[model samples]
Target: MSKSVVPVNIADKLSQFSELWSQKKVAVLNDYEVKLAKLKGEFVWHTHEDTDELFLVISGRLTIQLRDADVVLEPGELYVVPRGVEHCPVADEETAILLLEPAGTINTGDAGGPMTKAAEILN
Candidate 1:
């Protein structure tokens, strides 16, 4: 059963999953979906052609490499990668990140490769 309304504890919810580089859906608001992911090492280079992607770091460090620079994010830092921008994320160690994106936005984006996952709703 779903509650009419409640609170979302990002840190607590993030601790429920351990899969690296896979996004787990936690909730939805209007057309946006709230998700969490644990990442490690390097991820595939890709781009979202339709919508921008938002990344808010919850733990460790994540570096998003763009064509011109690498954006490093620590806990509490957030970045919004505009649609159609090519990029790759690298994590030297375990890092948890919160994502706010449009519902049905695939993790691997336009480049959809081996790491692509169909985000699953988490109870």
Candidate 2:
């Protein structure tokens, strides 16, 4: 069997940040990056005009509000918001999630508001 480069504990990385909506890169594969973030409350409404976003819930609840419908994700669940789709994510309580996307995807996508965080931060 092939061995992993190393084990990454999602919970351990999640504990490295206390602020909500901040993401930390945990791993990389080719052109994609694996990230972990702590989320709560509603994120800014935005769209990745050039790329899609994948959200995997590690714990707690995540509600992705889409233009036409809302998707609720639970632990072990995942959702991919297609490119150019405007959506908002809200967490009634603190939630932990993993994201898979192109290496340079900004957290706020096209919004780029004050909440937009640099994508290079790693754990």
Candidate 3:
């Protein structure tokens, strides 16, 4: 197998889409997919039973609402939601984030609704 040596610009890939809550797969590492999403408003309360979900703020702010407390993240910050933990992501304004999860992990997790979107490769 041949792999090309290339760099993926996060800003460039983010510029390719404007739809909120939609995930764009930018790269893959091992079995995990590196994804980017433009988020606004609130996301569904969900839980990935078998895998932890990583949310890395690229721009703006994100609040992960947990039953006990809220985890607030700003640009350059990240938080890992443990498996089986229900969390709802809320953004007061337009925010860009990077998500790291296993391949084929559903955006909505256990809470499947209209907000759920299958991640598509940015390329």
TM-score top scorer = 3
After superposing candidate 1 on the true structure, give the runs of residues whose Cα lies further than 4 Å from its correct spot. 1-3
lDDT of 2 by residue, 17-71 (tens): 8877888888887899998888989999999999989999999999999999999
User: Which lDDT tens digits does candidate 1 get at residues 1-123?
Assistant: 756676888868887888888888898889999999999999999999999999999999999999989899999999999999999999999999989999999888888778889887777
The CA lDDT at 101 in model 3 is 98
What are the Cα lDDT values of the candidates? 0.90, 0.89, 0.96
* TM, every model: 0.94, 0.92, 0.98
Cα lDDT tens digits, model 3, 1-123, are 988689999999998999999999999999999999999999999999999999999999999999999999999999999999999999999999999999999999999988888998899
Worst 10 residues of 2 by lDDT: 114-123
For model 3, the superposed segments whose C-alpha errors exceed 4 Å read none
Give the per-residue Cα lDDT of candidate 1 at 7.
80
Give the residue spans of candidate 2 off by over 4 A. 1-4
